[model samples]
Target: MTQVTLDDWAAMPRNRDEVSHGVLVAAPLLDIRHQQAVTRLAYWLDERLPDLVALAGVELLLAEEPLTIRVPDVLVTSSTDLNVRRISPSDVRLVIEVLSDGTVRTDRVTKFSEYAEVGIEHYWIVDLDALTTRHAQRP
Candidate 1:
Protein backbone atom coordinates (compact mmCIF):
# COMPACT_ATOMS: atom_id res chain seq x y z
CA MET A 1 0.00 0.00 0.00
CA THR A 2 1.91 2.98 -1.33
CA GLN A 3 0.58 6.42 -2.10
CA VAL A 4 1.61 7.99 -5.42
CA THR A 5 0.85 11.67 -5.68
CA LEU A 6 -0.31 13.49 -8.79
CA ASP A 7 3.03 15.27 -8.72
CA ASP A 8 4.82 11.96 -9.17
CA TRP A 9 2.89 11.18 -12.33
CA ALA A 10 3.04 14.78 -13.53
CA ALA A 11 6.77 14.43 -13.12
CA MET A 12 6.63 11.89 -15.90
CA PRO A 13 7.50 13.82 -19.01
CA ARG A 14 4.56 14.49 -21.29
CA ASN A 15 6.65 14.48 -24.45
CA ARG A 16 9.00 12.25 -26.35
CA ASP A 17 12.00 14.09 -24.91
CA GLU A 18 11.12 13.17 -21.34
CA VAL A 19 11.65 9.60 -20.26
CA SER A 20 10.63 7.51 -17.23
CA HIS A 21 11.98 4.06 -16.40
CA GLY A 22 13.78 4.37 -19.72
CA VAL A 23 10.43 4.67 -21.43
CA LEU A 24 9.24 7.69 -23.39
CA VAL A 25 5.60 8.54 -22.91
CA ALA A 26 3.36 11.05 -24.60
CA ALA A 27 0.48 12.35 -22.52
CA PRO A 28 -2.78 12.93 -24.29
CA LEU A 29 -4.35 16.37 -24.13
CA LEU A 30 -8.08 16.40 -23.67
CA ASP A 31 -10.29 18.21 -26.15
CA ILE A 32 -12.98 20.81 -25.39
CA ARG A 33 -15.77 18.48 -26.49
CA HIS A 34 -14.46 15.85 -24.09
CA GLN A 35 -14.66 18.28 -21.19
CA GLN A 36 -18.17 19.39 -22.11
CA ALA A 37 -19.38 15.83 -22.49
CA VAL A 38 -18.02 14.87 -19.07
CA THR A 39 -19.70 17.83 -17.39
CA ARG A 40 -23.00 17.19 -19.13
CA LEU A 41 -22.95 13.51 -18.25
CA ALA A 42 -22.20 14.23 -14.59
CA TYR A 43 -25.03 16.73 -14.37
CA TRP A 44 -27.42 14.36 -16.07
CA LEU A 45 -26.51 11.56 -13.67
CA ASP A 46 -26.85 13.83 -10.66
CA GLU A 47 -30.38 14.74 -11.69
CA ARG A 48 -31.39 11.14 -12.17
CA LEU A 49 -29.63 9.40 -9.28
CA PRO A 50 -29.66 10.73 -5.74
CA ASP A 51 -27.46 8.03 -4.28
CA LEU A 52 -24.72 8.78 -6.73
CA VAL A 53 -24.05 12.25 -5.33
CA ALA A 54 -20.40 12.53 -6.28
CA LEU A 55 -19.57 12.16 -9.93
CA ALA A 56 -15.94 12.68 -10.88
CA GLY A 57 -14.53 13.35 -14.33
CA VAL A 58 -10.96 12.61 -15.33
CA GLU A 59 -10.07 12.30 -11.67
CA LEU A 60 -7.11 10.20 -10.69
CA LEU A 61 -7.76 7.15 -8.59
CA LEU A 62 -4.79 6.38 -6.39
CA ALA A 63 -5.36 2.66 -6.52
CA GLU A 64 -2.09 0.74 -6.98
CA GLU A 65 -0.48 4.06 -6.32
CA PRO A 66 2.62 5.09 -8.23
CA LEU A 67 0.81 3.64 -11.22
CA THR A 68 -0.88 7.01 -11.83
CA ILE A 69 -4.41 5.77 -12.25
CA ARG A 70 -6.25 8.43 -14.24
CA VAL A 71 -9.50 7.83 -16.02
CA PRO A 72 -11.10 9.98 -18.65
CA ASP A 73 -14.74 10.88 -19.41
CA VAL A 74 -16.93 10.03 -16.42
CA LEU A 75 -17.19 8.21 -13.05
CA VAL A 76 -20.08 7.71 -10.64
CA THR A 77 -19.80 6.55 -7.03
CA SER A 78 -21.99 6.12 -4.02
CA SER A 79 -22.20 8.32 -0.90
CA THR A 80 -20.15 5.95 1.26
CA ASP A 81 -17.08 6.65 -0.82
CA LEU A 82 -17.75 10.39 -1.24
CA ASN A 83 -16.06 11.58 1.95
CA VAL A 84 -12.75 10.06 0.97
CA ARG A 85 -10.56 12.14 -1.31
CA ARG A 86 -8.77 9.24 -3.03
CA ILE A 87 -10.54 6.03 -3.91
CA SER A 88 -9.44 2.47 -4.58
CA PRO A 89 -10.38 0.65 -7.79
CA SER A 90 -12.96 -1.50 -6.01
CA ASP A 91 -14.90 1.59 -4.99
CA VAL A 92 -15.37 2.68 -8.57
CA ARG A 93 -18.85 1.65 -9.75
CA LEU A 94 -18.55 2.80 -13.32
CA VAL A 95 -15.74 3.97 -15.60
CA ILE A 96 -16.41 5.71 -18.90
CA GLU A 97 -13.65 6.53 -21.34
CA VAL A 98 -14.55 8.78 -24.28
CA LEU A 99 -12.26 7.75 -27.08
CA SER A 100 -10.10 10.37 -28.75
CA ASP A 101 -7.62 10.22 -31.62
CA GLY A 102 -4.60 9.61 -29.38
CA THR A 103 -6.33 7.30 -26.95
CA VAL A 104 -8.34 4.83 -29.01
CA ARG A 105 -5.83 2.04 -28.72
CA THR A 106 -4.89 2.67 -25.10
CA ASP A 107 -8.52 3.10 -24.15
CA ARG A 108 -9.59 -0.05 -25.93
CA VAL A 109 -6.69 -2.21 -24.78
CA THR A 110 -4.43 -1.00 -21.96
CA LYS A 111 -7.08 0.75 -19.89
CA PHE A 112 -9.56 -2.02 -20.44
CA SER A 113 -7.14 -4.50 -18.85
CA GLU A 114 -6.16 -2.16 -16.04
CA TYR A 115 -9.73 -1.43 -14.98
CA ALA A 116 -10.55 -5.10 -15.08
CA GLU A 117 -7.50 -5.88 -12.99
CA VAL A 118 -8.71 -3.40 -10.42
CA GLY A 119 -12.15 -5.02 -10.44
CA ILE A 120 -14.23 -2.27 -12.00
CA GLU A 121 -17.80 -3.50 -12.37
CA HIS A 122 -18.86 -1.61 -15.46
CA TYR A 123 -16.71 -0.02 -18.14
CA TRP A 124 -17.59 1.97 -21.26
CA ILE A 125 -15.74 3.41 -24.20
CA VAL A 126 -17.70 6.10 -26.03
CA ASP A 127 -16.99 6.86 -29.65
CA LEU A 128 -17.74 10.55 -30.08
CA ASP A 129 -18.05 10.66 -33.86
CA ALA A 130 -19.99 7.43 -34.30
CA LEU A 131 -22.15 8.15 -31.22
CA THR A 132 -21.69 4.59 -30.06
CA THR A 133 -20.42 3.19 -26.78
CA ARG A 134 -18.67 -0.12 -26.19
CA HIS A 135 -19.29 -1.84 -22.88
CA ALA A 136 -17.35 -4.39 -20.81
CA GLN A 137 -17.56 -5.87 -17.35
CA ARG A 138 -15.26 -7.72 -14.99
CA PRO A 139 -15.57 -11.47 -15.43
Candidate 2:
Protein backbone atom coordinates (compact mmCIF):
# COMPACT_ATOMS: atom_id res chain seq x y z
CA MET A 1 0.00 0.00 0.00
CA THR A 2 1.18 3.52 -0.86
CA GLN A 3 1.01 6.00 1.97
CA VAL A 4 1.17 9.75 1.77
CA THR A 5 4.15 11.78 2.91
CA LEU A 6 4.01 14.51 5.53
CA ASP A 7 3.50 17.31 3.02
CA ASP A 8 0.82 15.47 1.13
CA TRP A 9 -0.90 14.35 4.29
CA ALA A 10 -0.92 17.92 5.59
CA ALA A 11 -2.12 19.36 2.32
CA MET A 12 -5.06 17.01 1.99
CA PRO A 13 -8.36 18.79 2.60
CA ARG A 14 -9.33 16.39 5.36
CA ASN A 15 -6.72 14.43 7.29
CA ARG A 16 -6.84 11.85 10.03
CA ASP A 17 -3.38 10.48 9.36
CA GLU A 18 -0.05 10.57 11.18
CA VAL A 19 3.45 10.47 9.74
CA SER A 20 6.03 8.23 11.28
CA HIS A 21 9.44 8.50 9.63
CA GLY A 22 7.77 10.25 6.68
CA VAL A 23 5.17 7.55 6.08
CA LEU A 24 1.55 8.32 6.70
CA VAL A 25 -0.17 6.02 9.15
CA ALA A 26 -3.89 5.99 8.77
CA ALA A 27 -5.82 6.44 11.99
CA PRO A 28 -8.90 4.35 12.45
CA LEU A 29 -12.02 5.42 14.26
CA LEU A 30 -11.63 5.17 18.00
CA ASP A 31 -13.91 2.86 19.92
CA ILE A 32 -16.16 4.37 22.61
CA ARG A 33 -13.87 3.32 25.42
CA HIS A 34 -10.87 4.91 23.79
CA GLN A 35 -12.83 8.06 23.04
CA GLN A 36 -14.13 8.20 26.58
CA ALA A 37 -10.63 7.89 27.98
CA VAL A 38 -9.40 10.76 25.87
CA THR A 39 -12.33 12.95 26.76
CA ARG A 40 -11.99 12.26 30.47
CA LEU A 41 -8.27 12.97 30.45
CA ALA A 42 -8.71 16.16 28.49
CA TYR A 43 -11.39 17.31 30.89
CA TRP A 44 -9.25 16.55 33.90
CA LEU A 45 -6.36 18.43 32.49
CA ASP A 46 -8.56 21.37 31.57
CA GLU A 47 -10.08 21.60 35.02
CA ARG A 48 -6.95 21.09 37.10
CA LEU A 49 -4.32 22.69 34.92
CA PRO A 50 -5.95 25.91 33.79
CA ASP A 51 -2.59 27.30 32.72
CA LEU A 52 -2.07 24.85 29.90
CA VAL A 53 -4.14 23.94 26.84
CA ALA A 54 -5.43 20.41 26.69
CA LEU A 55 -6.73 19.01 23.44
CA ALA A 56 -7.50 15.62 21.96
CA GLY A 57 -6.09 14.24 18.73
CA VAL A 58 -3.57 16.94 17.97
CA GLU A 59 -0.81 16.43 15.46
CA LEU A 60 2.65 16.63 16.98
CA LEU A 61 5.82 17.04 15.02
CA LEU A 62 8.69 14.91 16.23
CA ALA A 63 11.26 15.47 13.49
CA GLU A 64 11.47 17.74 10.48
CA GLU A 65 13.82 16.11 7.99
CA PRO A 66 12.53 12.58 8.34
CA LEU A 67 9.11 14.17 9.04
CA THR A 68 8.05 12.00 11.90
CA ILE A 69 4.75 13.04 13.42
CA ARG A 70 2.15 11.66 15.81
CA VAL A 71 -1.42 12.49 16.70
CA PRO A 72 -1.63 12.00 20.40
CA ASP A 73 -4.98 10.99 21.88
CA VAL A 74 -4.58 13.96 24.17
CA LEU A 75 -1.92 16.63 24.11
CA VAL A 76 -1.12 19.42 26.53
CA THR A 77 0.56 22.50 25.17
CA SER A 78 1.38 25.90 26.56
CA SER A 79 -0.90 28.73 25.43
CA THR A 80 1.88 30.13 23.25
CA ASP A 81 1.04 28.43 19.95
CA LEU A 82 -2.71 28.33 20.05
CA ASN A 83 -3.45 28.50 16.35
CA VAL A 84 -0.62 26.65 14.67
CA ARG A 85 -1.44 23.87 12.23
CA ARG A 86 0.96 21.37 13.80
CA ILE A 87 2.61 21.30 17.22
CA SER A 88 6.38 21.15 17.70
CA PRO A 89 7.74 18.69 20.23
CA SER A 90 9.31 21.49 22.27
CA ASP A 91 5.95 23.16 22.75
CA VAL A 92 4.38 19.93 23.91
CA ARG A 93 4.24 19.67 27.69
CA LEU A 94 2.49 16.32 27.82
CA VAL A 95 1.09 13.74 25.44
CA ILE A 96 -1.34 10.96 26.24
CA GLU A 97 -2.26 7.99 24.11
CA VAL A 98 -5.29 5.85 24.97
CA LEU A 99 -4.42 2.49 23.53
CA SER A 100 -6.49 0.13 21.40
CA ASP A 101 -5.63 -3.30 20.05
CA GLY A 102 -4.04 -1.95 16.88
CA THR A 103 -1.90 0.68 18.60
CA VAL A 104 -0.30 -1.41 21.33
CA ARG A 105 3.11 -1.86 19.79
CA THR A 106 3.54 1.60 18.33
CA ASP A 107 2.33 3.47 21.38
CA ARG A 108 4.39 1.40 23.78
CA VAL A 109 7.66 0.91 21.98
CA THR A 110 7.84 3.36 19.09
CA LYS A 111 6.06 6.34 20.61
CA PHE A 112 7.59 5.77 24.02
CA SER A 113 11.13 6.02 22.64
CA GLU A 114 10.32 8.85 20.24
CA TYR A 115 8.63 11.04 22.82
CA ALA A 116 11.49 10.56 25.26
CA GLU A 117 14.12 11.16 22.62
CA VAL A 118 12.55 14.52 21.78
CA GLY A 119 12.66 15.52 25.46
CA ILE A 120 8.94 15.96 25.87
CA GLU A 121 8.42 16.51 29.61
CA HIS A 122 5.73 13.88 30.03
CA TYR A 123 4.16 10.97 28.19
CA TRP A 124 1.13 8.99 29.29
CA ILE A 125 -0.50 5.80 28.07
CA VAL A 126 -3.94 4.66 29.07
CA ASP A 127 -4.86 1.05 28.44
CA LEU A 128 -8.56 0.68 29.03
CA ASP A 129 -8.67 -3.06 28.65
CA ALA A 130 -5.80 -3.59 31.05
CA LEU A 131 -7.23 -0.85 33.26
CA THR A 132 -3.76 0.56 33.62
CA THR A 133 -2.00 3.82 33.02
CA ARG A 134 1.68 4.48 32.58
CA HIS A 135 3.24 7.87 33.00
CA ALA A 136 6.79 8.49 31.84
CA GLN A 137 8.75 11.58 32.69
CA ARG A 138 11.67 12.52 30.55
CA PRO A 139 14.87 13.15 32.47
Candidate 3:
Protein backbone atom coordinates (compact mmCIF):
# COMPACT_ATOMS: atom_id res chain seq x y z
CA MET A 1 0.00 0.00 0.00
CA THR A 2 1.21 3.50 -0.73
CA GLN A 3 1.71 5.72 2.28
CA VAL A 4 0.07 9.11 2.44
CA THR A 5 2.42 12.06 2.86
CA LEU A 6 1.77 15.36 4.56
CA ASP A 7 0.94 17.16 1.34
CA ASP A 8 -1.49 14.39 0.34
CA TRP A 9 -2.98 14.47 3.81
CA ALA A 10 -3.27 18.23 3.54
CA ALA A 11 -5.21 17.90 0.34
CA MET A 12 -7.66 15.48 1.91
CA PRO A 13 -10.48 17.12 3.79
CA ARG A 14 -9.99 16.64 7.50
CA ASN A 15 -13.14 16.14 9.51
CA ARG A 16 -11.88 13.85 12.24
CA ASP A 17 -10.43 14.96 15.56
CA GLU A 18 -6.90 14.05 16.55
CA VAL A 19 -4.91 14.10 19.76
CA SER A 20 -1.83 16.32 20.00
CA HIS A 21 -0.55 15.49 23.42
CA GLY A 22 -3.28 16.57 25.83
CA VAL A 23 -5.12 18.86 23.46
CA LEU A 24 -8.10 17.63 21.48
CA VAL A 25 -7.70 19.22 18.05
CA ALA A 26 -10.95 18.82 16.17
CA ALA A 27 -12.00 19.93 12.74
CA PRO A 28 -14.63 22.67 12.07
CA LEU A 29 -14.61 24.00 15.63
CA LEU A 30 -11.79 25.77 17.40
CA ASP A 31 -11.63 25.35 21.17
CA ILE A 32 -12.86 28.39 23.12
CA ARG A 33 -10.55 28.03 26.08
CA HIS A 34 -7.55 27.67 23.84
CA GLN A 35 -8.63 30.66 21.80
CA GLN A 36 -8.97 32.83 24.86
CA ALA A 37 -5.61 31.83 26.19
CA VAL A 38 -3.99 32.55 22.86
CA THR A 39 -5.63 35.96 22.69
CA ARG A 40 -4.38 36.92 26.10
CA LEU A 41 -0.86 35.77 25.41
CA ALA A 42 -0.74 37.31 21.98
CA TYR A 43 -1.78 40.60 23.48
CA TRP A 44 1.04 40.27 25.92
CA LEU A 45 3.49 39.57 23.14
CA ASP A 46 2.15 42.36 20.94
CA GLU A 47 3.10 44.95 23.52
CA ARG A 48 6.71 43.92 23.07
CA LEU A 49 6.95 42.68 19.49
CA PRO A 50 5.40 45.51 17.54
CA ASP A 51 6.43 44.25 14.13
CA LEU A 52 5.17 40.76 14.80
CA VAL A 53 1.74 39.55 13.81
CA ALA A 54 -0.28 37.13 15.86
CA LEU A 55 -2.40 34.58 14.05
CA ALA A 56 -5.15 32.45 15.51
CA GLY A 57 -6.99 29.41 14.17
CA VAL A 58 -4.42 29.24 11.39
CA GLU A 59 -2.95 26.09 9.84
CA LEU A 60 0.79 25.38 9.94
CA LEU A 61 1.54 22.67 7.38
CA LEU A 62 4.89 21.33 8.52
CA ALA A 63 5.29 18.55 6.04
CA GLU A 64 3.93 17.12 2.82
CA GLU A 65 2.06 13.83 2.37
CA PRO A 66 2.01 11.48 5.39
CA LEU A 67 4.34 13.75 7.33
CA THR A 68 2.04 16.75 7.04
CA ILE A 69 0.99 18.24 10.35
CA ARG A 70 -1.38 21.15 10.77
CA VAL A 71 -1.05 22.98 14.04
CA PRO A 72 -3.90 24.87 15.60
CA ASP A 73 -3.70 27.62 18.21
CA VAL A 74 -1.32 30.51 17.60
CA LEU A 75 1.77 31.58 15.68
CA VAL A 76 3.89 34.71 15.64
CA THR A 77 5.46 35.87 12.44
CA SER A 78 6.58 38.96 10.61
CA SER A 79 3.83 41.28 9.36
CA THR A 80 5.02 40.75 5.79
CA ASP A 81 3.71 37.19 5.50
CA LEU A 82 0.34 37.99 7.00
CA ASN A 83 -1.17 38.34 3.52
CA VAL A 84 0.68 35.43 1.94
CA ARG A 85 -0.73 32.01 1.18
CA ARG A 86 0.32 28.55 2.38
CA ILE A 87 2.84 29.60 4.99
CA SER A 88 5.45 26.92 5.46
CA PRO A 89 6.91 25.82 8.79
CA SER A 90 10.28 27.20 7.66
CA ASP A 91 8.79 30.65 7.67
CA VAL A 92 7.37 30.17 11.13
CA ARG A 93 9.42 31.85 13.83
CA LEU A 94 7.38 31.01 16.86
CA VAL A 95 4.64 28.50 17.62
CA ILE A 96 2.32 28.39 20.61
CA GLU A 97 0.23 25.36 21.50
CA VAL A 98 -2.43 25.58 24.17
CA LEU A 99 -2.57 22.52 26.35
CA SER A 100 -5.69 20.47 27.00
CA ASP A 101 -6.19 16.96 28.30
CA GLY A 102 -6.12 15.45 24.82
CA THR A 103 -2.97 17.04 23.44
CA VAL A 104 -0.57 18.14 26.15
CA ARG A 105 2.14 15.63 25.40
CA THR A 106 2.02 16.34 21.72
CA ASP A 107 2.62 19.98 22.41
CA ARG A 108 5.37 19.46 24.95
CA VAL A 109 7.26 16.65 23.27
CA THR A 110 6.20 15.84 19.74
CA LYS A 111 5.76 19.37 18.49
CA PHE A 112 8.77 20.57 20.40
CA SER A 113 11.00 18.29 18.38
CA GLU A 114 9.18 18.95 15.16
CA TYR A 115 9.36 22.71 15.54
CA ALA A 116 13.01 22.52 16.48
CA GLU A 117 13.74 20.28 13.52
CA VAL A 118 12.07 22.78 11.25
CA GLY A 119 14.20 25.57 12.74
CA ILE A 120 11.45 27.39 14.52
CA GLU A 121 13.03 29.93 16.85
CA HIS A 122 10.64 29.45 19.72
CA TYR A 123 7.94 27.06 20.91
CA TRP A 124 5.49 27.74 23.68
CA ILE A 125 3.33 25.25 25.54
CA VAL A 126 0.53 26.67 27.61
CA ASP A 127 -1.21 24.58 30.26
CA LEU A 128 -4.67 26.04 30.71
CA ASP A 129 -5.59 24.12 33.82
CA ALA A 130 -2.29 24.90 35.42
CA LEU A 131 -2.46 28.55 34.38
CA THR A 132 1.16 28.38 33.32
CA THR A 133 3.16 28.53 30.14
CA ARG A 134 6.44 26.98 29.08
CA HIS A 135 8.72 28.48 26.47
CA ALA A 136 11.39 26.62 24.51
CA GLN A 137 13.96 28.22 22.27
CA ARG A 138 16.43 26.71 19.87
CA PRO A 139 20.00 27.87 19.50
Q: What are the lDDT figures for the candidates, one per model? A: 0.62, 0.81, 0.64
The list of candidate 2 runs beyond 4 A from truth reads 1-5, 132-139
Question: What TM value does model 2 have?
Answer: 0.87
Q: Which candidate is the best by TM-score?
A: 2
Q: TM per model?
A: 0.70, 0.87, 0.70
Please give the clash total of every predicted structure, in order.
0, 0, 23
Q: How displaced is residue 11 in candidate 1, in Å?
A: 8.9
Candidate 3: count of backbone clashes, pairs at least 3 residues apart or interchain: 23
Query: What tens digits encode model 3's per-residue C-alpha lDDT throughout 12-60?
Result: 6644343233233464454787667878887787677787777765667
Q: Which candidate gets the maximum lDDT versus the true structure?
A: 2
Q: Against the correct fold, how does model 3 do in TM-score?
A: 0.70
| Model 1 whole-model lDDT (C-alpha atoms) | 0.62
Model 3 off-target regions past 4 Å? Answer: 1-31, 132-139
Query: What is the descending TM-score order?
Result: 2, 3, 1
Q: Model 2: per-residue lDDT, tens digit, 50-133?
A: 788899877788887677878899999885767878888888888888878788898888998999899887887777876755
